[model samples]
Structure formats: C-alpha cells, structure tokens
Target: MTDHATTFRRLHQEGLLLLANAWDAGSARLIESVGAKAIATTSAGLAWSNGYADGDTLPVERLYAAVESIARAIRVPLTVDAESGYSDDPAAVGATIARLGALGAVGINLEDGDGTPEALCAKLDAIKRACAQAGVDLFVNVRTDIYLRGLAPEGERVGATLARARLYRDAGADGLFVPGITQRTDIADVVAGTSLPVNVLAYPGLPAAAELAQLGVRRLSAGSGLSQTLFARAAELARGFFRDGDSAPLSAGAMPYPEINALFAQR
Candidate 1:
C-alpha cells in the first residue's frame, strides 16, 4: 500500500492519470507493457468477461478473484471499480474494500448510482475507517451518477453533482468521478466546484486528453469501451469464419501469440 498509494495519489495531482481499464490479468499485463501508469478494472468489463451482465450483480468473491489475478501480474497501482460497494450495508462494503487493499489494490471507484447522497457518504465513511484499521491508504474514489442517471434536470445537473462531490469528499473520498460529463464548460464547472481530483469517462467524440487537461481533469478512464470493442471484434471474426470460412480476419491487427505470452513471463 505504501509503495502504490503514494504514487497513485501523486499521479492525480501532477498530470492526467489515464487508465486503460482492464477486466482480467492478461489485459492488465498488456496495458502495463504499453506503459500505463496505473491499472483500473471496469466492473462492466469484468462482468462481461466473466459471463455476467454489467450491473451491480457482480459477486464480491468473483471480483476479488479477478483483482487478485491482476494484482499478482502487475506492479502498477490497481484501482477496482466496486460498483455501489456491492452491498447496501456500509460495514459490509467497507470490509470488502479492505479485502481489496489486502490484495494490493491502491484504490477503488465506489459509485452512488441512483442511491441517495447520504447513503453513499455513509459507505465512504465506513470504507475510510476500514482502510485506516487495515493500515492501508486506499484512495476512495467516489463516483457520482447524478448526470449519468439523470437524477437532476439538465439545468441543475452540475449543481447536483457538485453538492454530492462535497459530501463524498467530506466523508473521506480522495477523488471524484463524473462519467456522463463531456462538455468542457460543464467539466470546468465541476473542477472549480470541488476540491477533489476530477475524473471523466472517455465517451465517443469527447474532447481529447489535452483538451480535458486544460479543463482541469485530473484523470480519464476508458470505462468498458476497450472490452466492448475487443469482444465486438471477436464476435465479428467468429461470424465471418462461420459464414464464409474466411480466416483472414483472425490475423488482422492481432498481436502475435509469443509477444502476448511474454507479458506473463518473469521480467
């Protein structure tokens, strides 16, 4: 925790902390080889990869297994997306997060979803206490879905998010993640309105990283886009192979087996 937490926190304050979210150990290692500063797991990606639908339905044990595998394979600080803390009980959620800390995770994304701000703050407080008890400085990234869930009217979205951001921060959050925000003005408003580091999702056609940084974004996440794209390609290849018996798509833009296999080898 000492080695990773300090670095992960420093990254958010310095420059853009771009995370190529991984669903498995293989993806974590691959992203690390390409020089990702940290590893973040996409709950949606993890669910899809594990044959479950994206939602708050992922079992904590399965999530732990995925994180454990990735933790063992990568040296970079890892942040797991623990959607809604996976439980309504704040203590249960905190215990689960503490388990992640033991597995070498430096941070977690605990979303509020459509839940109340008070409830999410309770979870944040509990998680902070659990981390302290465990002697781990886990970066609790509180994700507010006011925009994503349409919890407020268009005119009131920014204010709603800001209000929740302050509550989460007061409850012990280290960062704020607002996924549905794309507009530069709205982004700047959120940044100026909050003391926590702001993280935004990389939606299609959104501004580039340079533009986002100028808007005061401290982190950018690819969410489940990478997994969706990768799996989409696999489905396309399978469809083509069965329909036309053409294997050409198999070799197109695919990394060589040996190169990929080398990623797991001892360095």
Candidate 2:
C-alpha cells in the first residue's frame, strides 16, 4: 500500500511546501510544470473557478471528481480541501476522507469552523480515528478560523488560535492552519505556542519564504488567493479582447496550443 500520508508529511518537514490548489487537471499540470512539490484542491477556488458558489454548492460528487482529475494529472501527493466535509455528521465526513484515500489522496484540509469549538473538535476526532483505522497516514490539515471570522478581538488572535490549535493537535490533527493573520509578531507568536507545524496564508510583502521558514512554518497555503488573482487577470484580459478583437495582451504569443489541448482529456 502507498504511504500517501507519510509522503506528504516529509514534504512539510523538508522545506516550504508550496501547495498549488488546482481545481482541474490543467492547473495541476501547470503547477507540475513550474515544479510544485504537491497539489491541493481549493474548495472556494474549485467552486468559483468552475462557476459555482463557495461552500457545499459544488456537491461532494463534483468535488470528488475534481480530486480524481487532479490526482491523475500529477504524481505528487494530493491534499483535498473537503469543506466541512459537506455534512454535520463526523462519521460520514470521515467516510468521505477515507474514500478519498482510495482515490490516491494523501492529505486533507479539515476545518473546525462554522460552529462552536467543542463541536468542531468532535468532528476532528472522528476523522482522525477513521484515518487510523484505515491504516492510512492521513495528514489532516486542521484550519482554525478564529481570525478569519473576526472573533479574535483584543489582539488575542494568537491566544485564541493557540487554544484551537492545541485542541486539534491533542485530538490528533497533523497541522494547524490559521488564515488572515497579517502581523509577523503574531506569526512568530503562534508558531511558538504550538508544537504542531503552523500553516499561514500568503500575503504581499508580509514575509518572504525564508522569513516564514525561520519562524517554523511547515506549510503555506494560497487558499483562495491564487484563484482570485487568476480571475482578476482573466477579467482584465477579457475586456481587452472584447474591445480589441484578438489583439489582447494575454494573447501575447504564448500558452502553447498543445498544452491547452491536453486539458480536456478523458480519464
């Protein structure tokens, strides 16, 4: 049996694991071309990238299909963003993650969000037990959204995050993810507080890869930021082509036709 979780954990330990979130095969191949070590699915990016709303609007079948496409496209370990597991029941969600393992997935981003902390921890525990029972080394990327939800008042973001992180870690989470954190001091503080490797969202000019590496950041997820940037650029290019008729800046004699042709291949 392939040790998918084992393979993924090594990536976290060795260096900065830049997980390029790909909603389809083309993005996976493109990230592979640029030498990304692993590929991850973005729940928001996948839905929005494919013209659906965020959250469970995409459905489990469609999201699972996206993961299959990406897993087939790249050899690197794949981590899926199974948003809230799309269900309230933890056992059912754990079943979903285990099913993903059957499809060659090594890791998953599970969030303890959308409810109270105690409720979220129970869900996390359920998934961990399921992973262990399956004999799969599942790298559970636990996302703590205290800051993301604007609940970290009194500059207590670090303390709040630590509380969540400690709970998840003790509950058997593989990593702690805290997005929307903007301060370097807080970044260091959070990293200091948790024995688990910290994962932060990418921000402009906040910290370089080296700076984050020094702070003991094991993983750096682009979250939905990459998809947002891509769409923004695409919107700009669309306007140019609409008015200029094939004289757009994006059509600057690049994007090989063969690579584009390869996107729609049957699986």
Top-lDDT structure, candidate number: 1
Q: For residues 1-267, write the lDDT of model 2, one tens digit per residue.
A: 265567788888886787767767777777776787888878888898677898767777777787777788777788888877778888888888887776778888887665777776777778877877986667888888887787779488789999988888888888888887767899999989988888888766558878888888888887777788888988988987898877648767668787766654553
lDDT of 2: 0.79
Q: TM-score for every candidate vs. truth?
A: 0.98, 0.91
Q: How many angstroms is residue 33 displaced in model 1 relative to the true structure, after the best TM-score fit?
A: 0.7
Error of 1 at 183 (Å): 1.2
The model with the greatest TM-score is 1
lDDT of each: 0.91, 0.79
Clashes of 1: 0
Clashes of each: 0, 0
lDDT of 1 by residue, 67-109 (tens): 9999999999999999998899999999999999998899999
- Model 2, which residues run further than 4 Å from truth? 1-3, 248-250, 259-267
